[model samples]
Target: MSKEDPKTNSGYERTLTNAHIQLIALGGTIGTGLFLGVGNSIHQAGPSVILIYIIVGIFLYFLMRALGELVLSDLHKHTYIEFIEKYLGKNIGFITGYLYWISWISLGMAEMTALGIYFQYWFPHLPTWVPGLITIVILLFINLLSARLFGNLEFSFAIIKIVTIIAFVFLIAYLLVTGGKTSFGPVGFGNLAKNGGFFATGANGFLGGFQMVIFSFVGVELIGLTAAEAQNPKVTIRKAINELPLRIILFYVMAILAILLVIPWNKIATTSSPFVQALGATGIRNAGSIINFVVISAAVSSTNSFLYSAGRLIFSVTYDGKGKWNETFGHLHRQLPQNGLILSACLMGLAPLVIILIGNQAFNFISSTSTSMFLIIWCLMILTHLSYRKQTPANKLTDFQMPQYPWLDYLTLAFFGLMIILLLSLPANRMAMISAILIFIILWAVSKIWHQERAI
Candidate 1:
């Protein structure tokens, strides 16, 4: 209905509908994390990983509902970045926006690096940099187009992911029904606990799985970003966020359950894609290769979404009058943040180069930091909701409201707090958590210095 940026004169049209927002959120949440990272998570936590997904999914549901309420409370506002500045302070808003931008850039790098690794599965001699660079270039080209183009690409990617998961599940179901056997053994649901109990990995191992589990859901909140582009924020975001629980169950919970039914948890390969390994184990022809193709598609879709969001997020933050870089990065060209998109693409491309130069460990380290930073961002979203509730009177008008207000908000915060503590318990995430804190402190200090000078 509207075709103008809420805070700027630039006429950015709201062309996205409910379907675009729904599928984009699906594509964002179901990325390399489910396809690649879950293999390692299963190796660490055994069948209990299902519980981890459910737990995180539930908390995020509440978080998204809270965000939905905030967005719909004022249909004219495009993004929560501005809400932070309006309700909180300019400094918090500035820091949160930039941190989110940085997180997506890091995530884009991780997805691209995964793309290269997936490619190498076929051609052992192909350098990792080749696919990563090619992918970055391809996604950059796509993301530089109109916002509708980005939404359409995401919808296509979501379709590919849905088809692959359904195929995997049905294939496994058929094998189980027909009493199929492979080198591993007979297909049956007993595989879930056959190797060891559900918590076979012990309490520490189960807790350790939360880091990867939470990381897998990194892009779940991307739906909030899409609110600005929706044809109707109140209707579109509500429908999208309301369906999150079912989407999580279908995509994460049941899909993993299918994999476990076909093969023992311990038998699943930690280093390779578990879906590929499980199918190949069941004597499916070219199963691993076929699944690798799907994974490649998933990685590409994810990187494309992240690059698109990163650019828009930067534009959203800087376009506000108080932003430090408002002069040049403040506006859009041709209804798109062309300059911001180019800048983010260049920075994102560098991550793949780092992977090429430093090896897989670099990818792992940066990816961990990205996850940790995103966790902080999630916490901030909940905190912002808390602030919104506090500042607004009970009688304030809201087209959509998060059910079980204050309590749900409080529980969401507690869940995130526990996740941070669990994150610190693992050596893999400790450094990344430390790095996130350091970045925040540095940003706060710099923002304070700049503010005082401007005031003087």
Candidate 2:
């Protein structure tokens, strides 16, 4: 493929339709975090968990808007790394790119691990590593073969997730109206405050739930990464970002409200999936199996998204001359970065075996480390946008200016900082924070060396 070839030079297939893009975003953001982690969040915030999701949704909306604005103004076939490089200097871009790559790689591992756990429900005889390995191989092949295939697979996964959540909402409503085994008698809006009243756990509870709520919103920005591949980048990007708030409200807020109303918040289990437990509480015997399937789909979607993201992040770094632009890896075959895809698959497949060897506790530690790193990446992105705005001449800002300019960007950065402080203050998260800081320092040093070498 010639550098000038319209198809290959564009770096990805413009094969992702608006539906595919929206579904992929939905699949990517609404994952096990909502299905499984919500219980713990509810435990922390009680009914106020609803407010936590809303607050995070608002911030995430602003973040996506900033990203959409940036991508539209510079219509290069560029990834987020390219944006960082263009706006924050090459060194910073290089560091941010690699950090993101590592972050997603680790996240892919975490998703696979969760998949293995979910699979264990039906196939107790099967070792967790077996399913984990199989998932990695299948997704890797799909991603490597064609970008369109991956998009289609993700689209299907997204549909299953969306439909399931919607069904769950309806089921909860129906059960609440019909009454359950216990003489709950038409579980209504009163459930929101009946047990302990709204803010049942108080202000500290809301603050504690914020971290997990933010985690649920982790992959919402994935649409920005897919911009270079969207069939209509400009239109799709705007629609996807703009619809983020509604998606959060429908999927996270309303869904949780349904769960709490159907099953008392105090009764929600922290270890098991809230969805499953909530349904079971309503005397739905097969609820566990049903939720398992939904969660498995959610995990697969997350792994697929992470795999796609990992490949692009690595490819973007290569394009910027930070890594070898392996002809095989960066080249688009059937509108896919084949080598990058294969590499990501192999790494994810290997992660489970490596984790098993180290034990479950070690795997959990690594997962926490990855989450912390992602928070850092988010902070860097917001800061990079702030710097981009300041350095960009006022006259040039018309094309893609961040709304409220420095103020919104600054506010987002501050929130990110506060989250980091929370992470550091929490004893369990301290190790992850230290690890992330060390990784950042190492990347910063490497960037310095790379620049010096290039200057010579």
Candidate 3:
């Protein structure tokens, strides 16, 4: 590590290019949640799962726009929680900052745990925890080198995932048009309508799938996280946020639609990736293998990004703060948050052990837990945006404003609110939701104690 720079809070430079930001935006959304968790969505909602994705995507897009406006309003701020601090007050910022850091750490754990599952397709006998452990080590070394290297790695990984998804959509569409047959039988639109008539599992099933579907969109706002490191934040951030709609249509809607059109939704595998399964059914030599590799790359890519976010978040929250805790995590080395990266990566390294303890269920549990935390964080983020708009006059607002102002904010909040209710009410996700709530309460208490100490 380079000599520590304690005079300044962060060492991050604007080394992340526009292309890096763009692909990071794309790569962020297409991670473990979509690659593997979508199988669970298909299992619960059947073909109707498509609607659930669209609903969640629309709400998150609004969330991104709100975030973008907040970001554009002040380019010097480090992360989203700075806006939370500015608008919602400092205490909320402290709590939300820690919460956001933990959320990203857990997200890394979830993605690493997923690596084992993805690698299983190639080597069924391999231990589930092995791949994740090795990946965490290698990626940690790479991330420690420089911010530009991290951006380059994410850029390449994003390209691989995007190309694979686009190719899958086109190939599957052609197969559907030709009335081609797979092992699951003929590929056609009737596959969607016939098996329980689209709403195969009914309303209960559709609603039950919302938690997983919401989790699938977990990384959509990663562009906000990259703002501090991004070169030309004004142009790159706006362009990425504006193109969200097309990304949703292509990566989520089109890809899943093609998957279901090829293999009946009811037949989708919950244990493995549906994309691999759909391709495997085609009996096309190496098609399934190719997709399995891509999903592994997707997991690795997402894990890399999550670690990057977590390290930066820890540095952002603690930089310039008092106490030994902040002193340990806040400073930078070689203009990078080296201590933060090592600590976050080490915590993520523990994921394999958690995988051992939870067995087959760890990934879903960790992801749902992340979703629970982010739902709360996102609500705070929107509230911050609303507060920003309330305090700053129209003349002071940025050009990239969240259109329709307070109404869109409330609508987005309502949608997220409903999803939280669904999460708490659902038996499968209830535990994760409760755990998240308890963590928030604990963080609130911790922050209070910190305040008392400072007052002394």
| Candidate of highest lDDT | 3
Ranked by lDDT, the better of candidates 1 and 3 is 3
Lowest summed lDDT window (length 10), candidate 2: 1-10
Score every model by TM-score.
0.95, 0.91, 0.97
Q: Could you tell me the lDDT of residue 239 within candidate 2?
A: 78
- Overlapping backbone residue pairs in candidate 1 total 0
Between the candidate structures 1 and 2, which one is better when assessed by TM-score? 1
Q: Put down candidate 2 lDDT per residue, 1-456, tens digits, no spaces.
A: 222324425556566778888888777778867876687789888899998888888888878777777777665645877888877788888898889888888778877777766776788777767777888888887787777788899999889889988998998777667764423335677778777888998877777776667667777888988877777776777878878888998999989998887777888876567777766666667877888888888888888899999988777777624335545455556666667777777887777666668655544555667768878888878877777677877777645456887788888878878878887876766788889989999999998998888788
- The best-first sequence of candidates by lDDT reads 3, 1, 2
Off by over 4 Å in 3: 1-10
Per-model root-mean-square deviation over C-alphas: 2.1, 3.2, 3.0
The global Cα lDDT (0 to 1) of model 1 is 0.82
Top candidate on TM-score is 3
- For candidate 3, lDDT tens digit of each residue in 1-456? 112222223556778888999999998889989999999998999999899989988888999999999888887778998889889998999999999999999999998889999888889999988999899999999999998999999999999999999999998888988888999888888888977988999999999888888888887888888877777788899999999989998999999999988888877888999999989999999988999999999999999998998888898899888778889888888878888999999999999888889999999899999999999999999899999988998799889999887899999998888888989999999999999999999999998998988988
| Per-candidate local distance difference test | 0.82, 0.77, 0.89
Summarize candidate 1's per-residue lDDT along 72-162 as a digit string, tens digits: 7776565677778777788998888888889999988888778777888898889777787888887778877788888998899899999
Which scores greater on lDDT, model 1 or model 2?
1
Residue pairs with colliding backbones in model 3 are none
How well does candidate 2 match the true structure in TM-score terms?
A: 0.91
